[model samples]
Target: MINVNQITHHFVLGKKGNKTIVPVLKNISFQVNQGEIVTIVGRSGSGKSTLLNLISGFIHPTEGEIIIQDKKVSEFNETEFADFRLQHMGFIFQNFQLIPSMTAFQNIELPLILKGMSENARRKTTADMLKKVGLEDFGEHYPSELSGGQQQRVSIARALVLEPPLILADEPTGSLDSETEQDLLQFIRELNRDLGVTFLIITHDDEVARIGDRTIALADGKIVESGVFA
Candidate 1:
């Protein structure tokens, strides 16, 4: 589902003449097959998050190509990427990234609204998504009104509302307690198996890594190991 070929990214620090280039990812090459749960694990400063951002099209790769579903997305401009993302990719962030003022129903419906779906269709789709996430009764609650686990479920609902083929999650279980984290991981597995959705997750926790069909480990911006979890 994804192909990261010889991708390299670096940040330029200081003014033009006195600048130093600090590399964040170096020649990272990997592939995520359709319907697989692929996790990327790394320590702090290991560039795992940066790699996710690049694949998500939030930032362009400085060197190589990122091909998703056969499209060379690394070459797309911001507008093109934005449209493509809505149609093909979904995202889940550690912070949930929900609008505090909006109810869970509204948050989940936002993507459908953006896609120009009619209000009736949006309501039905969003309602189904909330049910799928086990948040049917919490639809009227705001982000602040829900527990961490509930909020994360709402976030997952929002991401899946569009039924995008690929979901890119960064630190998905980072803020949850151990039990909640395990629950979320199991939910992710169910989503992958039941819906045939592809997942590329970024995580630092070993427990989280264990849930992956395959894991890629990074250290100092390079892939130190890549293999099946067990």
Candidate 2:
């Protein structure tokens, strides 16, 4: 479903005035199959999130190519990249970046809404997703009115409502209590099971990585270990 080949990334590290081009990732390569959950586990500054961004087309790598469905995304122009992402990708941020002004249903519907899906289709899609994520009754509430876990569920609902082939979640359970985190993690697993949504989740928690069909551990930006752990 996704291919990353010979990817290397560098960034200016340290204070703005003293930034230096420090190599972070060195020729990393990996693949994610359809309907599988792959977890990236690493310490802080390990470039786990950077790998996700490279695949998402947020930033270009100095040396590598990313292919999705046999098309090289790294070669797309900015306009094409934007359109491709809207059509093929769905992202969940650790911060639950919801629009505070929009109701839960509105936030979940925003993507399809922008994609020109009809109102009836959007309604059916959004309602089904919310129900799947156990947020069917909270559609009219705002983000601020929802608890952290509830808000994250809303985020997940929005991310999946598009029926994107891949879902990239970065530190999805970083903010919740243990029970809530467990619940959210299990919910993610369910999505992978029921919907066959391929997932590449970035997380530091052991429980999070344990849920994956495979786990890859990063150390200083290198994938030191990768194998089937579950």
Candidate 3:
């Protein structure tokens, strides 16, 4: 599970070494439970993405802390954070950050390979993940050859291959057509249903948020509303 408490982020902007703080997040607090799907929904520049960054520890909060399991991320060393991310966090970025030259299977296996998994283990895991995501036949295809939706499935497989406890998806279906979006959404639904992969998704679409167990609404760097759907 993930917990955020009174978190805040600010960016300094100025000229000639003089910087003024432009606050990006303010007192954001929430917790996501294991096996739940939580959505942070808001329009562009509403601080949704900033909040995601704060949780990921890519940017430290000016105030407050994020706790994953029982450890405060703010206190973790760089090495420790790296290991934690590799072991427990799966990120599906708004932009599919796939390498153009790597095949779908290769991209999905990168994390395991980095952890020193044996070649046979890597191959087996990759194949199983592709099958899990319904990408078994596209394993040899590169990102450039896949459709937006197919690429997203590949990303999802990559994220799930580690069987990480938490998954962070930022605008995951943002670029796809409605049908493809539906397909991707269904896949995530099944993952949550069958694998118990906890997810914190940032999105602007109401349809996507509708599927979440709870909604956290953000505006101008603060959470204005949060509630579970009936």
Candidate 1 C-alpha lDDT tens digits along 1-230:
99999999998899979999999999999999999999999899999999999999999889999999999999999999999999999999999999999999999999999999999999999999999989999999999999999999999999999999999999999889999998999999998999999999999988888888999999999999999765
Q: Model 2: runs farther than 4 Å from truth? A: 13-19
Tens digit per residue, CA lDDT, model 3, 87-195: 9999997778898899999999999997899999999999999998888999999999998888988888888888998999999988888998898889889889998
Ranking by lDDT: 1, 2, 3
TM for candidate 3 is 0.96
- What's the CA error at residue 82 for candidate 2, in Å? 1.9
The candidate, 1 or 3, that scores higher on TM-score is 1
Candidate 1: the clashing residue pairs are: none
Question: Best by TM-score, which number?
Answer: 1
- Name the candidate, 1 or 2, with the larger TM-score value: 1
Please identify model 1 stretches exceeding 4 Å from their true place: none
lDDT of 3 at 13: 92
* Collision count of model 1: 0
Q: Lowest-scoring 10 consecutive residues by lDDT in candidate 2?
A: 221-230
> Against the true structure, what is every candidate's RMSD?
0.9, 1.9, 1.3
- Of models 2 and 3, which has the larger lDDT? 2
